[model samples]
Target: MMPSPGAAQPPSRGKARRGRPPAPISPGTGPSHRAWLEPVRSELFTSGLTLDDLVDRSGYSKTRISELLRGNGYYPAWELTFSVTRALGLPTPPLRRLWTAAAREAHKGPDWIRHCIEQVAHETEGPPLAYRAFCETLHQPYLQYARAFLLTDPRARGVVAETFDILWLSWNEAAASPDIRRYAWRLLRSRVMLRAARHQDGSPDLRAAVFSTDEAHAVQDPGHFMALTELIDLFEAITRLPDDQMDVAVLHYLCGFPDHQISHVLGLTPALTRAVDHHARATVETLLNAPNTQE
Candidate 1:
């Protein structure tokens, strides 16, 4: 039987083998890999399993296990990740989706991904038609928002795809919520922010430098030049705003959502939505006036 997250967990114990620690995950590793790594690391810490213990439990060599934990070398197949998660007493479904997304980020081909997935036992018959429809409806806007934030199409698509898979796993709770859209929106936001680049102060770093590229061409059209300049500054300011205000601004300005739609999407009252938008613009304007605030 597959281990459930709620299942009785193994007792924590200290490492059974000691030596120089595993190599750190390369700084250039993709966000998808980094995202999947968090829970694996947490489970390892919580279970207090050592490298030797994992090798014994997972039936993989010590070096392979170490490489998997550190996210070094090639992307892991679903079979290998599943074995490690099972050994650590972690749930498989969510991790499987995460691993799938990470595999795509690692540039593994579709044939390889399908092969990896086929190695695992089925979790459910399949997601319901309603769930599939909902996913399709949100896919474009979600991709657009993710792309704008991450500044890369591939990373955005991976994050959106992973978000949908995660939502499928909890569709019942989401459907029962007062506002399904709001619940799913929060879920997507959390996933995106988890993988987003951050400022030294820990706010999101939107990496607005892309706006400044092709300056010569942009300057040839004075109107376009001015707009791009303001846009870069505005987005930089938006990143530093408090979370609520930032979300409001992104949905309002970037996604082109009206106040009422933003209200529905975020489960906020119309009055509150307008108020948040007002505050967001006011703050952005203030930040724009402040020197050295824009990156």
Candidate 2:
């Protein structure tokens, strides 16, 4: 039999939920993806940078950059992500984080995505499908935060419950919120942070957020919509990563999680988390770019 995750520790509150069935996502659709483009769009207007300007600077074809901007097919690889960030002279960290965040959500299996889409499709006036996709993608950001910072599954589960409670009570505010995704993210993080402060057990408290509530947008910009028809070597190679590295890389590149948060879930130092992410990317890039692997 496979080893039990709970073999060493006592029953965590998370256990009850874990044993329980997952919340049913709507049954018809898959995780929908779309690219984020506002920063580049805004910059194009303000800085007078045209498509031609980005092409010469970043060396990507106009079609490629246009695809990236228009939320069209193909996930923005790191090269494209960096190219556009530099082309716009925007700080890469936030955009990269949000970009990764969107990717992680997209990488979630087809079932979850389908459910999210179907559920929203049924709503007469819900946020756009893109935004609902964001909400579905972040379904576990709190649990992730709790695991590392809360340091125990039960407490982590408790935090997740409480955070959701806050959400339930604030439905009016949420309904009125212009950016529901970001609004929910901040609420979750704030509650997590407050709990982290109260639960300090005299150990040095480590924080794992990539973008703080103030720095990151409440709802992520719609980005990372990779069309599966375009899945290639790097995509396949990503699946080969060790679980830890894959999670870190996913959150870092796909989910936009910073090292601190990734480390918390993996129980590693921030520096080590960054290293693993680098290693994973290096490995995937190598595998992705390798030729003649047709054995």
Best by lDDT: 1
| Candidate 1, residue 63: lDDT | 83
Where model 2 places Cα greater than 4 Å from the true spot, the runs are 1-36, 108-295
lDDT of 1 by residue, 1-295 (tens): 2324432244345656333444677786777786667556655655556777676667777887788989988888787787777776554666787787788789999999998889877654456799888888778777767766787889889788878866765566679888888888888898888778888877887656345344424565648767676667777888889888998887667767678867766778899888988999898888888877754
Clash counts for all predictions:
0, 24
- Candidate 2 lDDT over residue span 1-295, tens digit each: 1112222121222222222221222232122222234434544444555666566667778787777666566555645655654655554433444454455555755454344333311212233455345445655765765554455678677556544444433444556677555466556555455555331333213323323222233434454223221243333455466655655664565446767765654456778777888899887777666774221
Error of 2 at 239 (Å): 42
Cα displacement (Å) at residue 236, model 2: 46
Measured on C-alpha atoms, candidate 1 has an lDDT of 0.73
In angstroms, give how far residue 133 of model 2 lies from its true place. 31
Model 2, 231: alpha-carbon shift in Å? 48
Which residue window of length 10 is worst by lDDT in model 2? Answer: 1-10
